[model samples]
Target: MNRRMAVPEQPLLRVRNVSKIYGRSCGECMEGTGPERESNICPKCGSIVAGGPISFDVYPGEILCIVGESGSGKSTLIKSLYFDDTFSSGEVYLQNYEEGKTNLLALSSQKKRRVRNCLMGMVYQNPQLGLRLDFTSGGNNAEKLLTADWHHVGKIRERAQELLARTEIPIERMDDCPKNFSGGMQQRVQISKALANNPSLLLLDEVTTGLDVSVQARVLDLIRQIQRTLGITMIVVCHDFSVIRMLTNRTLVMKNGRVVEAGLTDQILEDPQHEYSQILINSML
Candidate 1:
């Protein structure tokens, strides 16, 4: 009997040595900045290394969390992944995009727009960034669908209604502007809008920040439900360990624009190996 080897699953998203620099580099930028250097700024060139040499793989349907204090560059890393801010160097590949042969950062603006609209979704910490304050909640979702080429008004409306309901928004409030809704409601609307296209990957950057504790719990529960039902991969950037523990299957601990630790979420929480990760876990208690 001949036995064949099983093929390994490919990552849905792959990032390698990705870095975003804010100023001109002195050729020693990476060498001078990182966790060991205790800084994200290059002393020789005065460049702010917002993030990178960051490398990680996100498997399909897995929820990965990036945790760090303010200025740890976790948010910057997520934003760069979405092309909200251009990264200075590195390769990013999506398995479904160009067969993972193309580096996303090298794509043209038009192609990047296509990727953003079709393959990926983002939920920002602030609803204002993700939603049109003056547009009706349904209208905001329609805008996203429209970008993805959903032209039929009736079908668009139907999809919008479905998403709103899924996110626990009242169907009657579909016509209401996000600005008029409570913060938690606004975030729910944002989530619905981001999910309008049924993106393969979702990027959530502190989505529960600033909400009441109970509201946060509801929102987090909604997210968990969505992931369970849709099997969508997610990369969540959050400073709170509790949120990370609640949501992520795996975790990355970042400091000074670099990842200091990466492992199973429960394992990392139970026994953080890095000093900064230990400090973070301690602070959570």
Candidate 2:
């Protein structure tokens, strides 16, 4: 006789009406690279400007797909949650907010850096952007674990090699830099490094966009398998409707920086509520 295993349940993270604004008429808003151009509020209407107030929750052992087209604010949502940008209104709650948990929107700059790279890992669309082109794949992977503070350097190196093998990339080729690896191979390395510290939340931002159709399928399957085994919560940002359907249980559709439709994967696909969602479904077909 076979016995079923018990699964643990917990709320991993939450985002509550996060809003970010760039420029301001009086120069009071946060000044930075991407937020330098837009006004914080409408001078004429006094309406809140820049990033929209966005809210969402990430449950343990669940893959949440945040779907939207270009400029629909999907990227902004991720950036805000990771504290890469400042929010002008509302707050982002992490792991028990009411009990005075760590405020995602209020961490110091240095703490934010630590939280992002270690506690929450992010995989960009372009793997090269995340990897050190000058370093070998093994070296790049090892760098992520530096934050882990593993005293035995040799053991860390061995662990990095093991990761490459686990991701199906031959350990022998670990010496090759990301520039030498194909797009698909580079993506695998990125994933291995993103999982360096066994993060609870993994933000995958269109991680398989540049790969070929066959490669995309393989990467998606690998992600599914890994998530099942590790029980990591993920927020996959993608424009491709089918990709979300294949990987996620629940889906949130965004249009013009706001949630238009959200529900179970099958229900959203079978009977869409928003016109944009309908167009997305038709395109996927």
Q: Give the best candidate by lDDT.
A: 1
If scored against the real structure, what TM-score would every candidate get? 0.96, 0.85
Off by over 4 Å in 1: 1-8
Q: Model 2: per-residue lDDT, tens digit, 196-221?
A: 87887898999889789999988998
Give candidate 1's total backbone clashes: 0
Scored by lDDT, model 1 comes in at: 0.92
Q: Report lDDT per candidate.
A: 0.92, 0.75
Please give the RMSD to the true structure for each candidate, in Å: 4.0, 5.5
